[model samples]
Target: MSYLRFDKTLLTNLEESLTREVLRTNRSGAYHCSTIVDCNTRKYHGLLVIPVPELDDENHVLLSSLDETVIQHGAEFNLGLHKYHGDNFSPRGHKYIREFECEKVPTTLYRVGGVVLKKEKVFVHHENRILIRYTLVDAHSETILRLRPYLAFRSVRQYTHENAQASRHYDEVENGIKTCMYPGYPELYMQFSKENTFHFQPDWYRGIEYPKEQERGYDFNEDLYVPGYFEFNIKKGESVTFAGGISAIDTASLNDLFTYEVEKRIPRDSFKNCLINTAHQFLNKQGEESYILAGYPWFKCRARDMFISLPGLTLAIGEVEKFEVVMQTAVKAVYAFMNGETTDLKVYEMEHPDVLMWAVWTVQQYAKMVSREAAKEKYGQLLKDIMTYLADGKHPNLQVHDNGLVYANGREKAITWMNSTVNGRPVVARTGYIVEFNSLWYNALRFVADLFVEDGEFSFRLNQIADKTAVSFIDTFLNEYGYLLDFVDGNMMDWSVRPNMIFAAAFDYSPLDAKQKKGVVDIVTKELLTPKGIRSLSPKSGGYNPNYVGPQIQRDYAYHQGTAWPWLEGFYLEAYLRIYKRSAISFVERQMISYEDQMTCHCVGSIPELFDGNPPFQGRGAVSFAMNVAEILRTLNLLAKYDNQ
Candidate 1:
């Protein structure tokens, strides 16, 4: 049996199946995502979504969906599903699905009368293309396959309607046609592996609703254009391939190309392999530079997320070369920011208060995973520069105090990762001496000191400052309740019980002693820990909101209040194992099992961004998150180390 397989009982149920999505990416900022039953439930769902760098930084949906109809003796059976206005689904293609499995690729089997058809979908790597192969498994009579292309040539963030500005003209290519809906966008080429006749019947399919967008309190209605349908005869035990891409290709090589791409896929046969495969999807290689996308469907290359996810996404998977390559691009951006120069790198928010600290920590992880000598040889100068910049108060938002701690001015903007805002004001304005920032600050100083131990003068200065920061960190954050406060600003101590304190215990050079670290861990285990992950805020706190649902504003309010973030669980588990040692291995293993069910939920074979903090924690936010996947992989790597010992 496949690791991720859904039978008829689940596939035919819209409520359960629609919640499960499948995502395929080409490593170059293009992706194909949709529901398991081939329904476009969200505006982000598309068969071919690629970034048009000429127009803007955002991704555009070129081909929204492809509707397939199997004709037997002139009787047509549409295998396409779409949600119309008023909770109505047209074509109802889900009913014909017998099985859906995603091991090598997304494969679905359908049964219609005397025909059994198998459909497999694959997204070509490093190319803006999607190939789907259709095979007639068994048929007693001749069959004709009709494919209708639904084009929504617009930004994924926006919807399109019927307009005269859209060119109705198309250019005929080899065994296909190429058309451009707008002037700036790239032309979409629809082609077939074998000879097929194209019929031009352009019409707008209006009022198609995206229920997921409507649930999030946004405009959900859209209009998709169907230019024409391609019909071809099929014989039993024969296969035909369809290609949708930004550029035209040789029709004769389509079959060979599909086979070559499928051969590169790593089968999702186990949980670990599934996560490894998911990790590869987040890597975006653009020419000489590489970046780790924060999340799927919407997020871009963010500095904080890139560093936080780098170690696990690459180093933990034994891809040291990739780790260094991505770091080469990121280090350049970091150097440009520190030197007061602008860079053309596509990475954003390079000046986040703790981004430099996180970058140092990521390097520290590389040193730990590979060797200190390797890390020092490659990133020694970069680490020295980052430390000098931070210690001298060179950062715009970060300030070094006399007490040897870093203070951030987050009141004016959402500087930290809890960056939700309303009306230009931060929701959680944690201004002074954030707990995690100080922890990371101390860790960075000590790590650099250890790496460059030969430099006696620099090492001594960093240790002296680290000692002072350690003394101040315990005095300021550790409260009477045996837990650390979230942040401290003068007399206004934000006493919200949060997962930020986990870093104080999880880091390699933690300030807190053994007993102190245990006190911090105990409170977190009692209050914020859940099956899904560590809650952003303790439920005992008055400001806690458990459900991340409702309208946009409401969801933003709860985004970091009590939403359980899977990424935080990595730190919590690491801290637990650090304090309890070998005795905690069984507990950590059980906690890892809690996430096994997630491999089949939300987005199959991957993890989501956040989950509801309450019972029956439903996943919320992005379908697949890089930080969540990376952290989980890191935790798995940690577990393996303990097992080997």
Candidate 2:
């Protein structure tokens, strides 16, 4: 059996199968996502979702789904699933699924009476294209295959309805058809490897309900335009490839193209390989610039997420070139931001107060991975400029106070990563001397000081500033309980037991002493640690929510209150090992069991953004998060280092 195989028992059950989503992406910000049974449970799910730079920043779903039918002895089997009104299902195609596995690429086996067929999907790298190959494994007689294309030419965040403005016209390209649903959008070119017939009959499928959307309290109903179906014959043991893309391709090369793309995939053969595969999926390379997408389905290239995730996503996986390219673009954007100029790169939220701090940490990882000499040769000036920028109090929100710690004013906006808002206001208004920011600030200062140790005057100045910051950090955040406070503003100190204080113990240059770091770790392990990750808040805290459910507003409220974030576990484990040394290796290894088991749940072969803080700890939020995946990989790398030692 394959590593990620599911039998008919699981494949036939809609409750289990629909929750297991699969994602395939092209490195250029296009992806194909749906459930294992080829059902789109969310509006963001589609067969071909790509970015149209001219249209807007958000991704658009060009081809919503493709319904497949098998004909044998004049009997037709509709092997496609869709949720309709009143809790109804049309086609009910999941019943025919015999097995679903994703060893190399997502492959599904179907048994429809006397015929057995296999389907495999691959999203081509660096291109806006998806190739699906259908092979007839066994058949008693000749089989006919019919494929119907569903089009939803709108942004992924919005739904479309039956409108007269939609173009019903299509043009024939060699062995295929090209259609453009609206103006200012790229024409969708769908082609087949073998000769096939194109039947253009434009009609709308109305009242298609997305249950996931309804659960999130959004509009669930949508109208999809079906432009008829393509009919073709297939002999036993024969395979045919279908390609959906924005541009026309040579029809005869479809089979070779599909095989080539499949060959490029890193097989999902083990837990580590699964994570390595998912790590590559977050990379979005455009022309000379490359970026790390925050998450799949709906996220963009946010600056904080890119910097936080860049090293683990690239360096840990041994993709050093990718690390360099992504950082090159990001460094340019950072320099542009400091100079008060607009950047051509697509990275968002460059003005966030802590992004520069994380960027320094990302470079610190590079120094550890390769060498300090190499890092200084490449990013030395960037580090100096960042420290200089922060020290001079040039940032709009971040200021260097006389106490030598950076203070941020998040009262009016959500400046930090816990940035979920209710009504354009921060949910947790963490203002004035956040713990992690100062932890990173002290670390960055000391790291740059050591890198430039030959410069006597510069290093001396940085060490003086860092010494004051260290003293101020402990005086401001450390409490009588032995653990650090979340933040301090004036006389008010937020005593919420949050995972943000973990950084104080995790970073290399921390203000906390050995006993103090151990105290913080023990408190977190007692109240906030879960089998899955570290909870955002302790249950003992008031207004603590352990579940991430209900409507959008309710989910946002619970997002950071008590939700367990897997990314935080990386730092927690790092701090654990730092305190306990080799004795903590077994405990750290045990914590990884839950994440390994999660490889087969939820998004399958990937980790989600967060999970419920309570028992069972069901995964929530984005299906494939960059930070979550990167951190897990980073932990694995850390563990391997200890094992070698």
Cα deviation of 221 in candidate 1 (Å)? 0.3
lDDT of 2 by residue, 1-645 (tens): 799999999988889998999999998999999998899999999999999989988899999999999998889999999999988888898899999999899999999998899999999899999999999999999799999999999999999999999998899998889999999899999999999998877899999988888888889899999989999999999999999999999989999989998898888999999999999999998888889999998999999999989988989988889999999899999999999997679999999999999999999999999899999999999998998999989998899898889999998899888998999999899999999999999999899999999989888988999999989998999999988999899998999999999998999888889999999999999999999899999999987998999899999899999999999999999999999999998999999877988788889999998999998899998999999999989998999999999
At residue 294, candidate 2 shows an lDDT of: 97
Clash-forming residue pairs, model 2: none
lDDT of 1 at 107: 98
- Tens-digit lDDT string for candidate 1 (1-645): 999999999999999999999999999999999999999989999999999999999999999999999999889999999999778999998899999999999999999999999999999999999999999999999999999999999999999999888888898888889999899998999999988999999999999999899889999999999989999999999999999998999989998999999999989999889999999999999888999999998999999999999999999889999999999999999999999898889899998999999999999999999999999999999999999899989999888898999999898899888998977888899889999999999999999998888999999989989989989998999989888988999998998998999999999999999998999899989999999999999999988998999888999999899999989989999999998888999999998888889888899999999999999999999999999999999999999999999
Note the clash tally of each candidate. 0, 0
Show pairs that collide, candidate 1: none
Off by over 4 Å in 2: none
* Candidate 1 structure, TM-score to reference: 0.99
Lowest summed lDDT over 10 consecutive residues: which window, candidate 2?
592-601
